[model samples]
Target: MPLLFLRRCGWLGLLACLLTACGSHQKAPPAFTASGYVADRGAMRLWRKDDVAQQTVNIVSVYSPYKGENTVITRYQFIRDDVRQINRTQNGEHPETLQIRFDDKGNPSFMQRQRDGLREKLSDDELALYQFEARRLLDVSQSLRAGQVILMQGRWRNGVMTTCDGNEVDPDFDRRSASWVAARTQRSTGQLGVAWLEAPEGTQLLLVANEDFCHWQPKKSEL
Candidate 1:
């Protein structure tokens, strides 16, 4: 009896060791791609409604402050690949929105919005969407104009970054209602909206960022 019990304990320890090793081998997610578009450049044009007036604005790009200020009225695009989309709307105004699309294999497809539509941004060989969006944002913010394409580059310290500030928590955790309620406390905060585009069989998901717009840490359900 003693010998049998000792053998069982040894087997259990080996199983635990194997499980832990497998868990450690799990891979982390790829870093986000970023780029900025030049809104003032001659090649690209900002979308303006016919009813809007055509004023002679400054040649320099104007960026809306993340806090305590009105909209900067610049045109910038923030895009992730096949993972999410973040659209902004405020006081009846429709701000720019981001979109992401994925391929059948569950890998992301680099796509871009052209002629007011989305097309693959990168070929299968070149998969770099985050870098493209980051650069586009920087260019637009740096030299914003009425008619130009600008994209911005940002990093996700924990989860992701959106145009709005003060909302840093990951906007992806919808199941945690308690956390969502706490995030709304900061009325001035802006959260990121996520949409997964699985092309041909695409799935659209909307993720709301926390009040800080920096971290994407989802709270525990019980908490």
Candidate 2:
């Protein structure tokens, strides 16, 4: 089992540290391939509207605070590969009023307004779907985030000055219901309201922080 230690060296997990994923060359920063969560509250632009369904958010995860809900408002086209990764996991029902909240212990649970028979803790395939949708919204938030969320993977070596902060890797994130992520894409009515509708399913994003912290932590259910 990996012991999560609260250290001043930031959130360099013991696994990554043991693997020595850290670097300090001063010039060539690592190009991380990871997903950022829009679980936090933020604003997003209407990047592209899905004239077909009229509701759907493509990506998420940003450094700065935002003013909008989960809506794509820009047409930037940055993270190509990250979009592909998110696309691979985008084959599921788009939630209308779904909200994912965490318990006191940092375990994950969910509640959607219109869904029936759904529980706070999901299981097996149910859990998978919840994660898929959660991650999808998070990725959409990442794409729309104005800038990159700081991320670095490596050992806290000696004399290696880095601007990387482990804000994403915090294991204790989403500890309360208020910190839970909630998103509801506005579905278009036929060809009308296209401006507020979600973008195409596979459109590329403009900017995304390669932070991997929000990827696997906050397990789906409490043990």
Candidate 3:
């Protein structure tokens, strides 16, 4: 039968040259995820790991609920997981401490922080959600190829409190400032935080997020 059709076309030409030499021996890099607001070198300052021991840092800065004068700073850190390591660098400028470890299926398996050159201030949609989470961690480098998710939607500003002059007051839990002028005549919705970083770029992820709001009592401001 024509020598079995030439041995089935020589086994389909050796399976297309071994699938083109395994797609040129694979290649791709650059990635990140652990959801926004991160700074590490073993914890130089700024972190957000969702949970493990809880964390929140951004030490100081006051005002700007809506640019009453443009001032915002209040930093702090300590994350639960999302692997980070860079530990030790106290005063070249900022970030002076950090240490973390977590993985074994909990994700962010190891971390360390510190890199004294503090420079944190991101907004413009948090730098387009950190360049779409470093391009979705370079398109899911691996975890078998996919497995890392983080999504956040806005319109929340509950109870406000972080003063020592760093602004954002509502001490009574919120409700004053001339009755918050009927909460600016009601229905405002403005204050956002969005994230979607995937993680991959020498793994050392972090994301310690925090939010609080619940003090809106306005129903009487008819011009």
Task: Give per-residue CA lDDT, model 2, range 71-168, as digits (tens).
Answer: 32111112221221121111124322334444434245433332333333335575456455544444343332222222222111121212233322
Cα lDDT of model 1 by residue, 31-121, tens digit: 2221112122111212211111332111112232323333332322322211122122122133332333445454555444322333334
Give the per-residue Cα lDDT of candidate 3 at 144: 13
User: lDDT tens digits, residues 1-223, model 3?
Assistant: 1111212323233233333333343443112212221221111111222222343111111112231222222222223322222222233323344333333343334443434544444345643443343233222222212222221212224433332224453322123332443353244454322111222221221211122111211111200
Residue 55 lDDT (model 1): 20
TM-score of 2: 0.22
Ten contiguous residues with the weakest lDDT in model 1: 195-204
- Give TM-scores for every candidate, taking all chains together and pairing residue i with residue i: 0.17, 0.22, 0.17
Best by TM-score: 2
Off by over 4 Å in 3: 1-30, 34-84, 88-96, 99-145, 157-223
Q: Which 10 consecutive positions of candidate 2 have the poorest summed lDDT?
A: 190-199
What residue runs in model 1 are displaced by over 4 Å at the alpha carbon?
Answer: 1-42, 47-99, 102-125, 145-223
The parts of candidate 2 lying over 4 Å away from their true place are 1-100, 104-106, 109-122, 147-192, 196-223
